[model samples]
Target: MQNSNLNLARKWRSKNFDQIIGQDLVVRILKNSLYLNQFFPVYLFSGQRGCGKTSTARIFATALNCEKLAEFQKNPKTEFPCFQCASCIAMQNSKHPDFIEMDAASHTGVDNVRNIIEFSTLMPVLGKKKIYLIDEAHMLSKAAFNAFLKILEEPPISVIFILATTDVEKIIDTVRSRCFQLIFSALPNDSLVDHLSKICEKENIEFERDGLELIVNESEGSARDAINLMEQVRFSAEKITKSNVQKNLGHPDDEKILMLFAKLSQKVEISNLLGYLSEISFYELSATFIWGQILKLSRVAIYLKYGVIFRTNFDLEKISEIIKIVNVKHLINVMEIFCNYEQVFAKTSNKNILLETLFFKILDHSNKIEVKTSSLIKEPEKKSSETVPWATFLQKVEALNDPLVFSVFKRAKFINAESDKVIISFFKNYEFLLSILNDTRTVWSLILEEIFKTKNLETQIVEKEKVIEQPKADIEVEIHKAEPVLEPLKKNFKSFQNSKVDVSDKDKWKLANYLLESFPGDLIEVKE
Candidate 1:
């Protein structure tokens, strides 16, 4: 019998292959191998945590050592272990002597590995085979792995080793090559929800579907996390409500998030939005969680616009409202902007200010896109003469004698053409190029005037404004003050006095020549 006081995640762990969820293909392959008795001696199970790697390893061990496995094999009625058997019961209770388990995270040294190697040398005390399950095997030290390698390569006839890890890349390639590798994937949301529902029913706990959905979303496809969250919510409140779920998870209410989306779509004032945001608890409104909700809504809107059927679990009316406000292109842009800012928001010390700024940016972008799109729809077409082919102009400039000027123009962007001027912009980093072009602006103006068959066409260069970040207060920057050194002139004066005062000396000759040229006098005596 299982302990009633055990946590939901522990009590509801899959005991057999059939009970495992969200890995049908892996389960099928493992079952076929077990039924045919063609299992390998060394197996590697790797994937995200709580995705059934350890559970499946334990189940496989139980099946391999079960006394009734032969009976079940002969009957063909059951493929899993007979839980009533001594070996199966012992494995379930984690008391089986032959079924040894090791946490490589704690025992990562060579001595710990040597103990396992020594144990593998002994025969099974009770079961037909002695099974070793090493969890977080990637944490094992290099020497420990080397110590276990020989035994793993050539273990006893009755020994089986199962190594499980979340990070397979960290494990040594040699060890990975020796074992038959199996990968487990995260459980899907629907599958996780159904599993959680079943557990809730079994535990006689009442839950709202929306509350379970919130839990599933928060779990990020981990079954163990979902069940643990459910257990937390269960103990926190008499019944699992959506509000209670959000409160427990430190997340804002779904309705408020949706309202925020609605306000963004409607282009709410930043001040108003900030005021509303201030009314809510900042601790509850995690920037990551808010971004996730926004991304979710954007994805749903995009899917709906593209005629893709997507279920967002929100009201259909609300979904339609948001879709009507923003097109697929707009939603994609929103997602991209938030995606880029995710790291910034995560690392920011003042999240509330950053969140408000993010909202303002989105609203500003939405307004600009909307206005531009509307103007494009309403504005009439212009004459060809009004539009300048900037590329052709650049090509002509390249063909000219001045390659330096052409290179500068290559980095310049054509802003617009006016009746009297052709405006072009350059990045702030290329301000020197702009300056050089501006010095020769008349040449460009004349060239443009000739090309366009118009006079008085001035060429204007503008530098784009760049945002510079303010230095952080916490950063300790040491500014070195340069001090001028005044060395004594006595050594230099002595060297000058010791020099020969003849005409061969360049200094003496220059001085004498200057005296003769300036004074028109001959020197009778020279003083050293």
Candidate 2:
């Protein structure tokens, strides 16, 4: 009796190389090998789960023994099996005597491997070649792999060995090095969507493009997972819309995700965001999933800011508006904060509080705000000699006979004076002295109180206004004016260098007199 409840993944399994999706390179290479009749003793197929590794192995094995392979190869076309043939029919019914399929996961013992080795020596009973396809080959025990190695390296000419594994690293290097390796990869998003659309059309199922896109994204490039998810959605709802998929899958809709991000960009209050979030059930959704969506949106928003739009469901205008309010820098800051706290969401038991706190943190970073400079580079207070107090404080500090305190105060310009505080500005060159003065302020507070007659005194130090650069034209004018003065000195110095002068003690007086006559400056000392 035919089973009525075969799942889509199994029902739609690829039987030929041409039927496979998202693995064109693997298909081409296999076809070329079959056309040339170049068969390797052992073949290794490796990739992530649901990536058609096992299916490709089956098709390759079937094609090698296809009765009409010579006819298919004569035309330079793919050597897909002629299903009408008796051999192909046996393969389709899973009753092929020469085709042996084993699951290494269940049969990992050395005894199980002995059976495979025993079968390797036998000739084909139904087809032209004997084939053994082992799935999850990495699950085999060390003894089993070792026992299978010699035969794997040197199998019978009529037999072929094919190993399919999700993790090729687990397979010993000796086993790997002896086989021709073919890597199966996850299908691309576009290819998966096309495949889904074709299946939906053939199955008479109703689906929206966006709905199919959600399934494809959730599958993360696995065709089997995608088809299974589509089947689940189809059974749960009459029509495959985005809402129905979200309802059945418990995934948050793109609209809600966009709305939440818009509110965050608007700098909404934490209470408002939390209240809005209350509508969605956290039990149905994982924090990591929501965070991943936000991260994707942030990346899209940043790209949209520069007029680059990727394949996404969010409206372009909406993203444009958000990017306008939140510049790239702000978006980058939010992404960085999200990444920094990503692991915390998975580790924390109370996701609600952590999620709320994360929302608050994102809100804080979403908007651009001016922050004050560091204490070392504070804005200088306005200068007003009339408003300042303690004019004789410098004199008092000088009287203390402490040169350190006196020097710090001497460079300060009085800016303001309050009842119990004094404000002073320091030149940029003297900014280094502020730290020294601040460190000693407590030690001299008593002295400051006596000088100002205040119970307690507070000193605030700030950097003075930066000096404006002299204009280029004015600088050129000053240079020109000084050139006349420098010209005479240059000529006199050159003459002194060229002249030969005796340097005896008595003749030293002549050089000194010569310098005095040549230059306008007076000679204060005569060094011998």
Cα shift from native, residue 13, model 2 (Å)? 0.9
Please report the TM-score between candidate 2 and the true structure: 0.70
lDDT of 2 by residue, 333-414 (tens): 7788778777887799977678767778878744444475644354987646643345566666777766666777777776
Give each model's clash number. 0, 0
- Which pairs clash in the backbone of model 2? none
Top TM-score: which candidate number?
A: 2
Model 1 clash count equals: 0
Tell me the tens digit of each residue's lDDT in model 1 across 256-327.
888888777667677777777777765456777777788888787777777787877666567777668665
TM-score of each: 0.69, 0.70
When summed lDDT is taken over every stretch of 10 residues in candidate 1, the lowest stretch is: 367-376
